[model samples]
Target chain A: MPDKEKFFEQIVRENRDKLYRICRACLADPDDAKDLYQEVLVKVWLHLHTFRGEAKLSTWLYRIALNTAILYRKQQNKHTPLLPQHISELPDASAETAHKQEQEVLLQKLHYCISCLEKQDRLIISLVLEEVSYKEIAEVLGLTVSHVGVKINRVKQKLALLMEQQAGAEIELDKADKR
Target chain B: MNFEEIQKNWQTQQAPAAEAKAGGATAESDLLVRVKVLQRKVMRTNLLVAIVISLTAVAFVFILRPLLNPNTIWYDVGMGLTLGAAFALGLLHWFKSMPWKKQVNLSSKAYVEQVLKKLHYLNTANQRLTPFFMVAILAGINLIYFDIFWNENIKLRLVMHIMLNAFMISVGAISLYYSKRHNDQSYEPIIQELEELQQKLEEV
Candidate 1:
């Protein structure tokens, strides 16, 4: 393979999961996430020549990925209201152990909570979950490091509240089913 | 569950490796082809617009001069200024939208800020230039025909001159109003979003 092609493939291999996770977190629909992921990769490939080594490749990827995802969401919003997927609709975890199954369920709940966030919040939280440093997140988002920290705290608190509400609603539903 | 647990699980979950690889290679080539096609289309369109505008400007200068007898120097200057302004504006637009400038590889924030700054500058420049260009063109056309009204014996010449001036002025005014309104409507939201993003970044 040519040098550019090899470079692209290397970047894709290293950051595919991060890009997809960011897309998936921002968009509720898996199909949309897939489409956006493909779009982001294609964009990255096309602009690969512009990668000046001033920032880490991952940071550059995050910038493009986040911008594409945000723009995609805005375009999608014009035609339809964005709705978070119900937790029941999530794919079943095939883990044999109960502990793994519980973890999978919690992960799905976390995804649901993320999907409920506003666009910027979703992006900030997704990067946080990816273990991106606060300063990097700030650079990726064009915000100050201090602002990124505050936004992350606010987004985490919001997610905690959303998860609690979801748990409460599930408990009430369980009681109703017993009745 | 707390964020740490969610984060741990997020890291551990399997990425769809096979699917990503399969889809990515095809998508990359397909995107390259699309980009090439788009670049060709834009170049073709720019060439076409330049040809059309050049032809129109030349034709108008020649065609309008013959309509008046004993044409004055103002007519020549007016026509020259009008067509010159039109061509300049057309070239400015083409240069602004050229594909080369769109490929900056800056960090996300810097990239967004760069784009926003470019857009703001373009919007402001276009807004400032449009009315002045329109008025100059209109004045040029009127000057080109000024001698016709002064020297001609026919009532039709006066009537025609008045009617043409009225039509041009009305069209210019209406277009200026709509163009400004449209620019504001289209750009304000994006500008607001970028500013909000900036503000979020700046929050201490």
Candidate 2:
């Protein structure tokens, strides 16, 4: 393979998971997330030569991924269905061991809470959870670093409250089952 | 669970398998093809619209000659200006919409700067062409009226001429104002953002 192709493959391999996670966080539907992932990859490949070494490659990748994902969401919204689809049905848990199944359920709940967030806040918190630095996140999002810090704190608190409410609801259901 | 625990879980989730083969070479090419196809579609639509409008203007100038003296200077000038403006506007639209080759070899910052430059050029072109187009069409219409009405009953011709001029002027002014406002609203923010991005790239 040519040197350019090899370099491109290496980047993809290293950051595929990060890109996938960003897509999944931004899009509620699994299929839409996958489509967005592919779209981002194609864009990255097409624009790879333009990478100027100005921003870190990973930061550039995040910039592309987030922008593509956000645009995809906007396009989807214009054609939004009368009934919003359920957070894409999680993969069947029956195949997993009990502990793994529990983890999957928790992850699904987490994703549900994320889906409830206002669009920009969802992206901010998703990057926060992904361990992207405040400065890089601000750069990707075109916000001030200080603003990113404040927004992240607010989003985190919101998520905590959501999780608590979900947990409370689950316990109440358990009590009903016991009765 | 707390935010930290959620972050840990998020990190542990498996990434999906790579769906495209070999650095997405096929997918990238597919996208390029789609873009080309869309560009062609736009060009076709623009050409069709241009042809139709040009033909209509031409026909209007020729078919209306029985109402005006063909030998009159105003009639000739009016037809010439109307056709010229119509064709120029069509040509301008074509130039603006046609796809240029992508400058893939340039660095990202340079590429963005190039795009910004092109956008600025287009905006400038539209701004300059718009007034000329407005004036040309307005002159054409007024001249055509002058040819047909200049020899008619004096009082009736005067009333009709004044009314037509007032109506066209109001429409032209309103249109020019809105076109400028619309362009500023649509392109100014994008231009500002790109400039900021270019600056950030340079600083880095």
**lDDT score, residue A105, model 2?**
72
Best by DockQ: 2
Best by lDDT: 2
| Docking outcome class, model 1 | incorrect
DockQ of each: 0.11, 0.12
Model 2, runs deviating above 4 Å: A78-94, B19-204
Give candidate 1's error at residue B193 in angstroms: 37
How much is A110 displaced in model 1, in angstroms?
Answer: 1.5
Please give the lDDT score for candidate 2.
0.72
Give the per-residue lDDT digits (tens) of candidate 2, residues B2-69.
67888988987755656443334333434344434444654686689688987887677677675444
- What is the fnat of model 2 with respect to the true interface contacts? 0.29
Error of 2 at B137 (Å): 35
Model 1 chain A lowest lDDT segment of ten: A78-87
Give a tens-digit lDDT track for model 2, residues A1-179: 25666777888888888888888888776666766776677678777889999998988999998888777776566322111224235567677787776677777888777877778877887789889999999898888999888999999989888778777877887799899
